[model samples]
Target: MAGRVGVVAVAQTKFEEKKATEHTAELMYNVTREVMGQTGLEFKEDGTGIDATLAASYDLFSGPAGAYMFLGYVVGAYRREDERVLEDGSLAVYYGAMQILSGHVDTVLLVSYNKESSVGKNLIEWVGMDQIYQRRIGLDFVSAAGLQAMRYTTKYGITPEQCAKVVVKSHRNAANNPYAMCCDNITVEDVLRSTMLCDPIRVQEAKPTPVDGACAIILASEEKARKITDKPVWITGFGSCYDHHELGYRDLADCEALTTAAQRAYKMAGITNPLKTFDLAEISEQYAYQELLWSEGLGFCGKGEGGKLIDSGKTQMGGDLPINPSGGMLSGLPVCVAGMQRVAECVVQLRGEAGDRQVPGAKKAVAHGVDGPAGQLQCVITLEN
Candidate 1:
């Protein structure tokens, strides 16, 4: 782990909720080429190729066997000799990091693409709902957030006004993100007045149904990193964990998976108090209530105290622990690309390259991602200067 794996270059497309005309591959290729160009790595001119290529997009999002071949060409790794193009982009980043640490690869490229707009459903909650038990009971994703929000409010006395604040805060924060899919001057009243997608969880409270986009990040070992970029954001620690997929079997209010994952990440980074140790955070707030729920899961506050924590402005950019400076998934969700987008944003922030949305003087950041219905899968990565 000492050789050091750092993100050298990162690029992303503007997130949107619909892309009816363009193919997903077009965005993926554009982002990949942009990131590689930033690394000054040219295939024909440099002779050295990326040690590995990783991409993520579930089978349902893309039409069929056609998408794989499409990706092969976009990455410039189209059946290169015996080289394998990994399709699980998130897992690819995990393995890419392992390869760099294990002396197998000096550099790796991670890409993820998903177009929720192309699919005829609310891709966010639709994908997570149980295909059998839960979906049969009419348990869609918005209801999942509503259920969790209700549980959180009941357990902690979080009021509707407070929930409105989270929505307003996210939109206000997102206004600063140029690549964000949705943002505008919105007030707490605006959130409360919006159409309710699910009881207690309004349309504005939810991440916009993602349109289409792709993201890519170039990772290099210490030796390769120093040669490429002067400011390389080091990957100090990473942790991922999963909870019981059955929503009925677990405490809906608490994210034990996140707690455990955060603990491991903090341990690896040698951090004990996240509030005091980390300068900023890019938490996944797919729902307004989740930002509050995960704040507790991440140990930003005592159990049942996340509502109060937000009330005190402790998570604002100028506060003690700013969370979701990118406006988070609430602004946009490219499904598979969302998690990696969080990572790339952190790296950009760490490198002082986040143009208008940069958190002032940010040196350390914690990015979080969730997969599965009812928060079943969680990934936590801690990055530092």
Candidate 2:
């Protein structure tokens, strides 16, 4: 907590089915310009504006060897230090915070983009898996998520109806989010009846059609943050963990990596009880069941009790601790940028800028993100206004 870092500004593009008109860099520039405009910062290299830049993108998904090739045009990385984070965009935020904490940078611009429509989503994800073990068997995120969902439900007695509620809630919350991709009114029955892509995982239960979008945020040191904005969402705590890469070697029903990451973040933030400490949560629930599974891992409920937690209505907008007021990943945020969008939503909520989805008087929040098969890698970030 010595060199505190705060989120000064955040911006995101509207999630769309296809962004054919604009290239990747163009999409990213839209978000970067918005954040820079809000903070009145220029893209200078004399340490007068952003001191560093961090970009997140997947080479396989972006159709380029070094995906960051066009990112420099938007983040203004002409002369200043800049790096590419190949993982989830949330990692870029994490790295930016570290740069500020290291006393080397006062302001860092973080951006991430994914154009799922530009490439075969499945084929791209397929290449990321173990070619010999997983890829040959046609293991993708959907099937892996189905395996995890089945294990979690069987262990906890969570019915498909309970999982459907997650989709219903996500769609409902998305109605108030302008950036959300799918905001149509939907019910649990609708979700249950939706096309079945995988067992216990209906089309509605899984993430909506992949969208093309970008997100940008500016992180600044305590001194610079105070000057940029009066309301700065401080990064109180953060941690990440990686589980076994081989799906067979791990228990899909449990998220030990997320649990350990949350525990480390909670301890660093001095949060003894996450359920009562944070006003709300923004989680990267790529699938409906993931919300329940991850909530348990985050200590919002006991293991095997995620179903009961959802039934309690405690995570609704007006509930004790709302989750995913921005509709979360389920609303069709791009994969790589989903986690950063969660962080941006939390920042908006904490700053009282989340117009329609704002939780009343939200003072603190927690955001979660994951990567790899079955969420093998997980990251947790705690924020305070």
TM-score of each: 0.93, 0.98
lDDT of 1 by residue, 1-385 (tens): 6488888899988887777777877887888889888988754424265767666666577766446665666776654421332232444555567778988767877778887776654543565577878767877766777787777788888777777788777777888889887787788888889998877788888878755888888888998998988998888877778788787788888889889988888888898999988888887777888888898989899888888988999888788987877888888866667778888888889988887778888899888877766567777788987
- Candidate 2 — which residues are off by over 4 angstroms? none
TM-score of structure candidate 2: 0.98
Worst 10-residue lDDT window for candidate 2 reads: 66-75
lDDT of 2: 0.89
Estimate, for each residue in 1-385, the C-alpha lDDT of model 2 and write its tens digit: 5579999999999999998899888888899989999999887767779888888888777777776775576778776788888888878888889888989889999988989998888778778888888998999877888899989899889989889999989999999999999987899889988999888889898886669999999999999899999999999999899898888898899999999999999988899899999899999998999999999999999998889899999999899889999999888898989989899999999999999999989999999988877898899999999
- Each model's lDDT: 0.77, 0.89
**Positional deviation of residue 292's Cα in model 2 after best superposition, in angstroms:** 0.2
